[model samples]
Target chain A: MTFSLARPSTIVEALRLLADDTEGPTAPLAGGTDLLLDLDDGRSTARRLVSLDKLPWKTLAWDGPRLNVGATLPLARLGSDATVRARLPGLSEGVDAVGSLALRHRATLGGNLGRAAPASDLLPILLAVDATVRLVGTAGRRELPVARFLRGSRQVDLAKDELIESVSIPEARLSTYVWQRVRPANDVSQVGVAVARSGSSASWRLALGGVLPVPTRIPEAEVHLTEERPRPEDVELAANAAATHARFVTDKRASEAYRRRLVATLVRRAVARAQIPPGER
Target chain B: MTSEVALTVNGAAPRRLAVPDSERLLDTLRWRLGLKGTKEGCRTGDCGACTVLVDGETTLSCLTLTHEVQDRAVTTVEGIAEDPEGRRVLAAFAAEDALQCGYCTPGFVVSLTGIRKELGASAPDSAVIEALQGNLCRCTGYLAIVRAVARIGNGNP
Candidate 1:
């Protein structure tokens, strides 16, 4: 509650502020939805906050095959942007499922991935889409796969002076996302699944979240489903394989057994949804 | 440390004040500026009672630091009273008896106003529902609120 805030106008200045030792450890603030809560609840002991609001990282650009989403791009845009909705419907669906409309207006992609919460809606979809994250620091820029960027719950593979710049997702085909929660809507997912395909059924990518300590891709299940275009029986087998790969723990929102079951069900549904023709969907 | 930050509120002239770095915009509006219309039901971002507009975008004031809004335009419920669309939405809410306890009304009104601005004249029923997801009404069961928004969007009194 008692922290000094530094609003740096440029990325370099922001990185400098984060590296400064005189003010104690500084946490980067992007769309303060989660950071402010942590600051309010005494969960964060950061004595200083480096605001990324002024940085010129609010753009969403498509260069050839890669779509670059700035870390600070608000989640609201993800739902409403025509280009994003057209090309990355799975990511759009995941972003839309986050909190509420007002919260979406303020929540940013960086904050969503930076917090690395187990139930984050974006992480599973990003993993399924094979997104790459870009980070900048005094050491210059580095890119890492989304799965590797996340270290653990409430942790990221970011250094004290580093800031996430953007995430790049390659173009893919026949992708969709689905989730199941205890609440009807506007609640964190008990189990979420995203499936993306590049060409054939064998090229399918699958990721699951909320049933594990981290959002993760299930290559074992994906390989099983890719052997053939998923039939009802194939879906059931793939779902069971996904459930086997998932590690769930009982939380206040759901039981371990229930979440594991949800993992199977949502995975099946997500893949089936992904296989539907665009015209029908 | 406290610093002087200047920003426009409700289309007013820019106002400057020395605010603490940790001060949230919700506190600044309610306590410092005496704009009590922006309610603070939950200090966390879970509730939409503290919703406001920063640079014409719906934002949760409880999570927005006062300093972060420096030199930007902020719109609270009090500032939008004269806006034609805002007035129409409020009138529709009144006609539908959309509220009971009324603590969450200001937030709903502000959020709906933002939705109207974003969607313009053709706001769909589903978009309105999505927009209202952030707001929670403990008293009215939300049916009246949805009906009010639908009526306003449909050009019906």
Candidate 2:
């Protein structure tokens, strides 16, 4: 029979429980959306659970250059946070698009980041904003870039005994982008794209979820598209570069050919949208 | 092998119990609490059939832990008629004939209730879409359902 442990209050207390080696294969429980389901279905690799229910880490703050969002902050809070809505609206919009209202209220930023699903909405947005994840372990705390932290689908750079403390988004140039996708209602994603521009330098952070082994970033495509915008030759070159970099495997949800086509179409539109001002929308 | 969890279900005070770690919140609600109104169709979070309002937000009970909900408020389908705001959405669902099979109705109702409550007076069309994105309904194709719930805030159907 499986068992659960519920500890009340404080991040330090939660961290101690999470880092407890004596607990024996313990997994930290945040929203319990993904982890609990896995456990119910007998698919869980977890032996013990350290609940973060009362952890005092639910806050969203802006400190000029960086926006410090507690890992426990839920999607609803992220979507509605005035600072997020004003500064990093892309990240806010991404969080708003995740799951349903109920899930959003319960699903935490840490859980989503920890789960590290390529289909994770906030991740693609975080990549655009260049956010960093703060992970707390028994020894101390450390930071990892969002782009690098996500090692693969449902995987992260988190050590076995570490817990994600929070995610910080450093302020960037005032830029606009678009998140365009075609998916069944509440379904993960067929093709999701996030692109941005900084100074004269434009960048595209294209994430293909439910399409590849992990959220793959096509810098080659991004370079081609940003350097030579709208030129037919450049567009084709960029699209091909994206397809070359995108290692799409056929999933039950979608095909590699369909995803490739989406990448081409979405990359073009994302670039065009980024060129427009925010007020235009 | 077992642990006790305390929770507030549908406006009542917290009720405490001990169960095996493997038991889901949905199972505990039905088998233990006897609140049979919250139905379970898909054991996974994919289907909205097992939806409930946890801390006034809609979530899949089947995918939630009984222990995690300690001291949290859970609004189930049975409680919809009792809540003044929730009743409005429920009434809208009823007046529009928004349900066919009715199996997915409770989850839809709870989800809509959460949407109606969260968005309040200024919920834009996009906000409404985002709020209800997680729910899946085969009966209405969600048009009538959306139309029914959309009328609540703007007071225009």
Candidate 3:
């Protein structure tokens, strides 16, 4: 029943608010789609929630090389932006599928990544697009690759006095890709496989939620697909390795065995769909 | 612990008050604003029964803090008909028999209005369905709801 709310109008002010508060569990609130749920359910340890909507941190801009998405940019804007939809179709599609339109309209890409949920729709795409997170703290701004930014499920590398400012996605023509998954009857994702292929480098970005602790990527599975048609046997081997790498767990929604089975099937389907020419659709 | 939370509610400025830090926007709307049209079916974001529009974006009022929405514009189902597009959406919902139990209707109406306003003529059927995935309607099926919005927006039966 006790919580401190801090609203800052500028990024520097927000950073200072985070840096100065050394007293309790702290979390930055963007849209509150995820963090508020955790708090209400007693799953979060946040006692001091720093509201970021007051700051000038919701702008979306392109600096000619990278797309600088403010930490507070809602998921709706990310998905609806024409430039994003055309340039990063995979990311746009992923954000579009995050929740109901209402949730997406309020959920922020930074908040989604900051939550680090294995089933987070945006994480795999971020990994596939080579996105980086910019964190501001007392020491100044530092950038970390999306892969390294997420520490684990529900955990991040953000210090007590730090906040993610924006995520910079390098401008890259997203080759054909597919993000297919199985969700519970309620549209909650069970297992997700995000695949992206460059001109010659076909990469499979695998991320599973509901049956694992956090979103995971299998480098071997991705690297193995760079060559000719991947045989089912090859995919099976890669799926097992990826599942093992993810430390697949048995959760109420899906068992580890079922998840493993899905890994193989989803990986194969994702790769096949990724090879489909963009204009064909 | 008292804070002055001010925002434009339904195109009108209401008397700002000092609310406790623990109050959420959903509770504030129901208890303070007395706008009972915004139902609180679930305190969590999983259910869209508590959906509202903040700064023209559909958001789960249950999850948003009242203080966080200060200086923003809030549009609830009650306030939706103030605009031409909103009137069309509401009329369509009524014409389609979209509500049975009616508890989730207001949220759906607000959400659909927001989507149609944003998508205009370019929004597809798949996009409409995806936009409404969060809203749960246990009654009247979804045909009427979908048909109402589609008919109003597209001018086709």
Candidate 4:
């Protein structure tokens, strides 16, 4: 219930503050949507909360076909971007799937990645799009694929003094995300499926969210969906494989059997939705 | 754990106060600033009862730390009707009778006002609906709320 806030105006100062905060556990505060809740519920013991407000990370830029999303950019700014919608529909879809407009106004993609919640609406889509996390620390700067960065539920590969700088997404792809949830507004998804095909290579990437432990990419399923224009039966095989690929568990959000079923159904639906016409591709 | 802070509330001049770092914006508004219009429903972020505007954007005050919004402008339901869009939203809600228990009305009003400002006057109905997805009405069946949204989306606001 008690904590000290340190808002550093520069990256160096921020890093030093985080590194020097030997007071209990320390947490880097982004939007505070998830972290504050954790702190309130005794889920976090972070006595020193470092705010990233003054850092120049609230950027969203396009380089050729790639997109670089600044870590502090609000989800609302990202979701409402016409370029993001036109180029990366699945990413936009996932952004829209989070809590609400008000929450999204304060929720940042970096916060979502930093928290790494088991059912984060952004993870599956980030994996499907081959997004890489960019981090900076006293040690220096480095990048990691989102898959490698995720360790487990509420766990990430972030170091104590390191801060997420931005997320680098490869070329935009033909992609979409679908999910099943009790309430469309504020509830967590029971199962989320992301389907994507690279615009240049035409290869496929399949990822599932709301799974046990952590969300993961289904390479076995992606291999089945190799063709740019897959046959109907191939899509079916990929969907079935995706359902079989994950290790589902019966949790408070959904039953194991129900989640697997949802993975299959939503994957199939998302694949169809993400499919591009031969002329367009 | 506490520090002196300054902020603008409802178009007022910047005021300074010392507040605890653990205090949420909702707590600061209701308990410190004596602005109880922003009700606390879930205390969690799930409910929209603590909705307020931070620098013209809708934010969940219950989840927002008071220090997080230091030096920013916060507009609660109490000050919403002063804006032109807020005036229209309030009028539409009144015309549509968009209240039952009225506990959620302030949040709904503040949030809708924020959405309208963000989306502009000609935002589509779907956008309006989607923007309000976080708000909940435990009183009425939401038919009246839907009507109020329709009225606002149609140029009545």
Q: Sort by lDDT, best first: what order?
A: 4, 1, 3, 2
Instruction: Summarize candidate 4's per-residue lDDT along B1-157 as a digit string, tens digits.
Output: 8898897899999889899877889989999889999999998789899999999999999988888888889999999978998998899899999899999999999999999899988888788877887889887548888889999877774
- Candidate topping lDDT: 4
DockQ of each: 0.79, 0.61, 0.66, 0.85
Give the alpha carbon lDDT tens digit for every residue of A1-281 in model 4: 78989888999999998888567778899989898888888999899899998899999999988899999999999999988877888898899899999999889999999998878899999999889999999999999999999999888998988999999987555888898998778999999998787765456898888886888898989988888778889989998999887988788888999888888889778888887532243
Q: Where is model 4 more than 4 Å wrong at Cα?
A: A199-202, A276-281
Q: If you score just chain A, what TM-score does every candidate get?
A: 0.95, 0.87, 0.86, 0.95
lDDT of 1: 0.85
Evaluate all candidate structures by whole-model CA lDDT and list the values in order. Answer: 0.85, 0.72, 0.74, 0.88
DockQ, prediction 2? 0.61
**Predicted structure 4: clash tally:** 0
Please list all clashing residue pairs in model 3, or write none if there are none.
A118-A215
Interface RMSD of 3: 2.1
Question: Over all chains combined, what TM-score does candidate 2 have?
Answer: 0.89
Interface RMSD of each: 1.2, 2.3, 2.1, 0.9
Minimal lDDT window, size 10, model 4 chain A: A272-281
lDDT of 2 by residue, B7-125 (tens): 78878778788867667789998999898888888776777888888878777888787777777898888887777777877777877778778888888888877777777757776
Q: Whole-model lDDT for model 3 versus the true structure?
A: 0.74
A120-239: candidate 3 lDDT, tens digit per residue: 767777776667999888778899988888887788998867888899986544423333345422355667776654343454444444435676667866656554456777766666
Off by over 4 Å in 3: A21-23, A175-186, A198-211, A228-245, A277-281, B154-157
Model 2, span A179-231: residue lDDT tens = 33456456666666666443434544444444455665677876665552457
